[model samples]
Target: MEVELKLLLSPADNDKLLQHPLIAAHARAPVRTQQLSARYFDTPDLHLLRHGAGLRVRKIDGTWMQTMKAGGSVQSGLHRRNEWEGPVDRPWPRLGKLRKLIGDQQQWLDVLAADDLKARLEPLFVVAVERHTWDLDVDGNHIELVLDHGHIERHGRHVPINEVELELKDGDPASLFAFALRLQEQVPLRLSNTNKAERGYMLCRQTGTVPCRAQGLQLAPDATAADARLAILNNCLQHIQRNETAVIEGDDAETLHQMRVGVRRLRSALKLFEAAAPCPPALLEDIVWLGTELGAARDWDVLLASTLAHIQATPGGRSGVLDLQALALKAAHAKRSEAAQALLSQRYTRLLLTMGCWMQQPAPEGLEEPAQDFANRIMKRLHKKLLKRAQRMDESEPASIHRTRIAAKRARYALEFFHSLYGGKALRTYLKTLSSTQEQLGSHNDLVVADRLLRELNQQHDAAAATIQFARGYLQALQTSRTPDLGAIRAALHALRLP
Candidate 1:
């Protein structure tokens, strides 16, 4: 297994990094520089990629080495993957050597033995870098820090790379992050999960930007609450960081929404595990602040795309629809820009470091209970709170219903986090019903928020007043048209038996 943390730096930061006092003070020997060229191989259809594996052969100095990396989890910037490497005499990959390591694993054997497998292997991309390596003893841990400057090339096209990898040679993995955080104070760095091979694969396939969804969690049956909480937090953080580029570089609404969802999920996890490992209030506030920044943009996007579209389709509402849409879109774009800037700010970087540090800390004493037991207690508590709020749904007040919606959402998120632990028809049914109820309540809440926003916009833009009035009326009508089926929601809530 190879464990390392990767951080990306701007090209300008490269020179400053070499002169930094920290680097000079910790160096055990003079920095060693070498040229490295690697060629990645895969089948025409990307068989290895689908199986979460990467194969590459590189020439360093005058020696050739082949490496195989597969199946691993990435949390923040840290990557822990199964890696096998050995020196070879030639430039071509020696797949048979890797095969020997796998023994008789049938699945792997079948893929390795596919007809023309060796023949089909083609050079996907070339990574050529000038690597600078330093061996440092940080707090008694042996750490190897390597800085690579080069490009990933494919068919004459290339993407520049200026990144640092801190591999743990010996001792605690936590030290890697600690060193990273300290180094971050002098140089701006972003946590990067995109490995060299992944960038090559993307370039080879000419892949475009796409929204990142949450990856499923795989937990053991006997995992403890602390274990589950850490896994859930890691999953949420990955979702947020994975979509960072798409959210900032591309104007993809879904990506922004997913990013916001990731933030919400992280906040929810913090609350869910509060009893076991309470997050600092300051950290919680920062998370909330970032979420609000993201939400401002996302809320407008929903109104412009969905709610406004619905209003435009209604009679008498189409008169000023175009004008209103133009104004809303302008505002939405501005908010998105603001949200993107927030992501790039130093505050956001510090927040990531804070959360990373918190994650490495030991769980509180009380969190050692089995996950199943913890899930049962937490689920029942959240469900009861949700039910109590639902009981007041008959009031039909916007504020009251909004509160219910929030409760439902929290309960639903809790269910989702623990669903894998207790999977059955009942859990599925409960989730389905909860989803339906949450959607209905969410729509109602959107109307309430939309009306308020329209009123505010109406005050600012005299030309949009008529359009805002029309929108408010349409939203009220829509809200009245679809009442939430509270009775059915209650029935589902009651039917759920805590596992």
Candidate 2:
């Protein structure tokens, strides 16, 4: 996730802005209030959310203060300064003040609106601070409290995290640097320049993923390896069952998508591990079937987005471009619907039962699986080799990087497959970088795949042909631009000592 450091200054504090180096224009004017909401999302363990909402008042002095806000926060919610403004001192007693207004069981809802702003606020910097947040219900409507103190404590797949945000909810970008400079001294805790939402997402995406059974055991003994492998496979299957339950219950798209990705990765890891310790042919077959069905929809969603993006970006010159693009999009949606339907079928349940029964049997004696430390070591070794291979392939033959990336991804998955057992801050950090790099390469690869599909569309018009050519060129250019400095990224990955 990205972090940021924020300094908020309201209209009342506008004159204070004159103390700063950046407030030359607004020496007499006050910062205006504009409506804004920032939400933070996370699980109890802080694995999923560390987000918030803010209605900021910005001054020319580079300070921006948060005001009463509305809307849903990702993990944190409804933290506005007006609520915190009483006779309270710095780091106001938020929970105490909040509880006095509304009890723990009732949730509060407020609609805040303001309109008076100029400035795109683009090319902005995110100022953040580490802070702990509680996801409990305050007065029933889910309320998260973000304290002034930046605190993070890792437990299982969650953590205690916080943030300090800085931005003019009214869309002004001036005074950011100057405000940051001032806040650096007033705030007692270490200031962070990261976006909590981005940081939390990266943390969740990289860390806190449940592990597979294969990750828990060493592939040393034939019998023990077999038992451990099956155990991991069952665990992976159980992960699927858990996620499937959420999907069946109509979980949000993001959560469901996360679960779906887990299912696919676990299934893939199990298949690879099972190569050494073969599972029942029938059991393996069932797992593959589920993965394929789910993967089809997921893959289609990814492809469709790219295709639509391409067509949308095209100029007004191409004839029949709309028709071909429509056909491709329709095909993708159809595939997604079909896959979703298949996942909800009775056969999926039967497969789930079969897999569950397999996981229930007791462990064989002296199984003595591989240690977590050892497995992590192997994963890192594989990651380093694969990364080098990816860079090497980038220069010589990009085609080969595809396979090399898959190998690195597999290793990363193998490690993350047991995200529950060895999850922590460092591991989370590595996984975050790994996943980001993987995504960039993966997106590049997706464009390559999409190009192949477009080339196969068999369009005939000269205009259509030209459009296709332009689209392919656009994709190629995008791919080139996305390929970042892999060496430095790799170094950063290495810096994170994975366990």
lDDT of each: 0.85, 0.45
Instruction: Write model 2 residue lDDT over 107-191, tens digit each, in one string.
Output: 3322111121112111111223323222322122222223332322222344334333543233212222233333334332222
| Model 1: per-residue Cα lDDT over 1-499, one tens digit each | 7999888888898988888788788889999999999999998899889888898999876889998888887876679987878888888888888788767766666667877878888878999999999999888989999999999999899999999999999988888888888888898887777899999998988887789998777778999998999889998999899888888888999999999999988988889988768889888888999999999999899889888888777676566788898988998999999999988876687678778777877777888889989889998888888888877766357777777778877877888888888787878777787788788778877777788778878988997777788778878888788766667766766676654
Off by over 4 Å in 1: 100-111, 394-396, 480-499
Q: What lDDT does candidate 2 reach at residue 371?
A: 39
Please give me the total number of clashing residue pairs in predicted model 1. Answer: 0
Q: Cα deviation in Å at residue 489, candidate 1?
A: 4.6
RMSD of 2: 21.5
Q: Candidate 2: where is the Cα deviation over 4 Å?
A: 1-235, 242-256, 268-277, 314-322, 344-347, 364-366, 370-374, 377-381, 384-388, 395-398, 417-425, 456-470, 484-496
After aligning candidate 2 to the native by TM-score, how far in Å is the CA of 294 from where it should be?
2.7
| Reference-based TM-score of each model | 0.94, 0.46
